[model samples]
Target: MSDDHENQYHYTPTLWIGILFLVLFSISGILHILEALYTRLWFLLPTVVLANIGEIIGWSGRVWSSQNVFANTPFLIQICSTIIAPTPLLAANFVILGEVIRRLGQKYSRLSAKAYTFVFLACDIIALIVQAAGGGVASSADTDGKDPSSGGHIMLGGIVFQLVAISVYMLLATEFVLRYLKDRPVRPALVAAVGPRTLDTRMRLMLFGLGLSTLAIFIRSIYRVVELADGWDGRVISTERYFDWLDGGMITLATFTVNIFHPGLLLGRGNRWFGKHIDASGTSSRSGTFAEDATVVEPKRDNGPGAKV
Candidate 1:
């Protein structure tokens, strides 16, 4: 098991492809950072920005591999980066969903807002750690001139776990959406306009973006599970087209989703200051947190579209 350029990445990574993703992820990352700062959503800085960094590094490794395809270091770096890149973005999605539920319909949600954060983040962390450990193990084994199948198996297990977690999460999200629609829970009225538009439209666009991002990630996860199933040398891994579409393309779509339809548009200004009171017209002033769950309590007196306060 020499660490030569033999069949390591299966094919010479196209230089343009690597460069393209590098630029795309970089743009998304920059936009996300700017958006996070404007919205005071500091939380997104770590999650979305970190994922973008990983993708950037991974594709840079690919670009390096294009020049030196026989090198072990670049190949290992790319593989590891590509595998773990999406986990942080997935975590960001979880946070967004929790916030959406908190702002839109807390009573309709089955768990507290914090619960979704805790559970899904825990799952994402586990997947990330497992995959990272597998990469380390594989890199170590290659250095030691030992077989890397064990590490491949570990990576496959991690991907499978991720797939299961993502599926369960989607199911829960679907159930929540169903319950919300069936119950027709009253959404808190807009205390003030969200950027001169109604809250519903912004919220709807945010929801669509989240859904699109989640679906892209899920599709990528499934592809990864299959890619790593037959222990590194599988047909899936041998193909560049699959990785391009499933991995690079999917992440591109997911990352841009936030950039285009950032939740900040719906959150509006004064999102970080926790104790500010907003006076929704026709309603009493009430203190609202960044989540704005308090609006449902006091600030929004009338839930019906045309009801008198």
Candidate 2:
């Protein structure tokens, strides 16, 4: 083992685990692509597929590093790809949040669904750019035998920004849920427009999946922050086990969990809540409000007989 190799890992990356993650991410990506195409969810397709691609490439780098731990190329590839991969997945989550808010009714949320998507997506992009740039700088410094602290600090800044954004997003999501539960009217028209009882079950499942995935990504971000803050020769960065469990395991679980509750599978097809409303002239309305021709008879507020409790 070379002296430079001492900075990374005492042993090579676990080859079996690396191979397993590569296979899993590849399979999940293919399935996501097919599902997105079938459902015509163009907005979601690229973000998720690209994220999966990053995972595939990152794991490949890990496999390469296992064979040649002293190679800067594989190490950089693994670091950059893995760190930036989950970012697009986080964007995908933001995209779906808008659709969810729209479906459930915009009145339940403080911001418009479109606004939520736009703001968060922009923030995610900023984080991605900063992190990628930092990774590049660090890799170059490592190759040239220069100090990498500046690059590490840049990466740490990006991670911290992402952490704050996700934290705010979670808070907004919680508020939306609470508001929906408390203020949503129990009108027959609203119920019919949304869907049958099964739709409710699907919505719950989607929420659960989104929550779990968000938690996983958040945990991963914290781990990255800590690892990077400790610098290259820090205890956390030198340990492969922590990387495997906190970084690889969390991301893999997140990607898989989101696949199971994909928006294409859960929100597409006969879900009236997300369906387009057509005006009398046959033009699709972009305002996302109920169509003029559609009759929405609000339930009467009757305290006399059979009033809902």
Best by TM-score: 1
- Model 2 clash pairs are none
Cα lDDT, all candidates: 0.78, 0.78
* Poorly placed runs, candidate 1 (over 4 Å): 184-199, 269-309
Tens digits of per-residue lDDT, candidate 2, 269-295, equal: 322324355568866544343322121
Error of 1 at 203 (Å): 1.1
Look at candidate 2 and tell me the lDDT of residue 282: 68
Clashing pairs in 1: 5-70
Minimal lDDT window, size 10, model 2: 291-300
